[model samples]
Target: MSKIVLARVDSRLIHGQVVTKWLQQSAANEIIVVSDELEQDEFLQSIYLMAAPPGVEVIIKGTESVKAYWENEAAAKNSKVLFLVPDLTTLREMVEAGVVKEAIQVGGLGGGPSRKNVVKNINLSEDDVEILEGLLAKNMEVYFQAIPEETPVPIHKLIEKYKTL
Candidate 1:
């Protein structure tokens, strides 16, 4: 059975921190990117593939395709699996689609005009917070941390701190 080592939602699909920090901490051999855009864009998929270290296979699958892939031989062969999406809504969708429940470790969510509610480094929109709340209600752990060793800031407490706004 494949174990979900890391479930992350980042605006930047993949980057240096993901390559060095997360890959090392999770000891993940394969990085599975679940995105509809990446699935259709062969060029972007190639870019992500080239960016990753040699021997670390990068599999790009559509968000809706995750469930089938999860039960496939390839996913079963891997010991460590990292699930990544661009936003919280995608994570919630994946969970709703029956991806195994696990704690979601949030990383860098880049700054933007609409994303004004900043907690630690993750900028949460109202919809993002709602998705997180849904996940938390499902008993899925949600927290923020740029790196694995950093202190985890729980999403629930942060939401409580700023829910009225």
Candidate 2:
């Protein structure tokens, strides 16, 4: 069976850190980016395709199609995949749909109006916190770590620090 070596939620889907560090650390040869928005944009898809390392295969698919894609025999064999989703909501959807059941590495979430900084690179809104809490309740391992060399910060600790904000 194909292995989901790593599942990451990073707003910047494919970048230097992903290609140079995380991919090497996870030893993943395939990258499956789950994005509803990007799935329809061939231009953006091409950008991500070009950004990925030469040997790595990258496939962009909508959230709804992930389960079916994972069920494919070809997809399940001879592949070590690093799955990428943009946010916790997408991660939750994949987990609930049984497409992803592994631990998730939370990366850059980017700051916005209602969001608060949880770590150096991670920012979360109330809804993001709630989704993360729900994932924790489901026994999912969710943590934030910008790079492979850095120590991961547990989701609960960030929740405790930002719950009152």
Candidate 3:
């Protein structure tokens, strides 16, 4: 089976930090982005492909299809994969599907009316917190670590900080 090097929840799926920091840090050769929206948009998919580094392969798939992709023998035997999902809901779905077995790294969620800043470059809404808390309850390691060099902040601590706000 293919080893999942990192499963990251970053709203900006494939970007500078991911390409320059996380990819290099994790030594991931393939980036698998799971997003239903992106799967239907060839333009955006092309853009994401163009953004990735020369040697790294980028595959965009919908949430439902990821389970099958995960089970594919060719994918499993090929290379280390860095899985990226846009939000907590997608992460929850993947985890529930048995696709993500490792610790989940929270990169960035961005700011919104219902969302609160948990750490620098990281934000979460009430729904996001609930999903993450559910994952934590299931004994999954979910933490915030934007880049490779920074220490990971536990999800509960961020929730506690969010509650105080």
lDDT of 3 at 109: 90
Please give each candidate's TM-score: 0.90, 0.96, 0.96
Model 3 misplaced stretches (Cα beyond 4 Å): 73-76
Of the two candidates 1 and 2, the one with more favorable lDDT, higher being better, is 2
Off by over 4 Å in 2: 73-75
CA-lDDT, candidates in order: 0.79, 0.91, 0.90
Residue pairs with colliding backbones in model 1 are none
The TM-score, computed over Cα atoms with residue i paired to residue i, of candidate 2 is 0.96
- Residue pairs in collision within model 3: 2-76
TM-score of candidate 1 versus the correct structure, residues matched by position: 0.90
Model 2 Cα lDDT, one tens digit per residue, 21-84: 9999999999999999999999999999999998999989998777788888536578999999
All candidates: CA RMSD in angstroms?
1.8, 1.1, 1.2
Q: What's the lDDT for candidate 2?
A: 0.91
For candidate 2, the per-residue lDDT at 88 reads 86
Give the top-scoring candidate (lDDT). Answer: 2
lDDT of 3 by residue, 1-165 (tens): 678899999999999999999999999999999999999999999999999999998989999887888888425476889999999999999998888989999999989898888789878788988998899999999899987788889889999998898
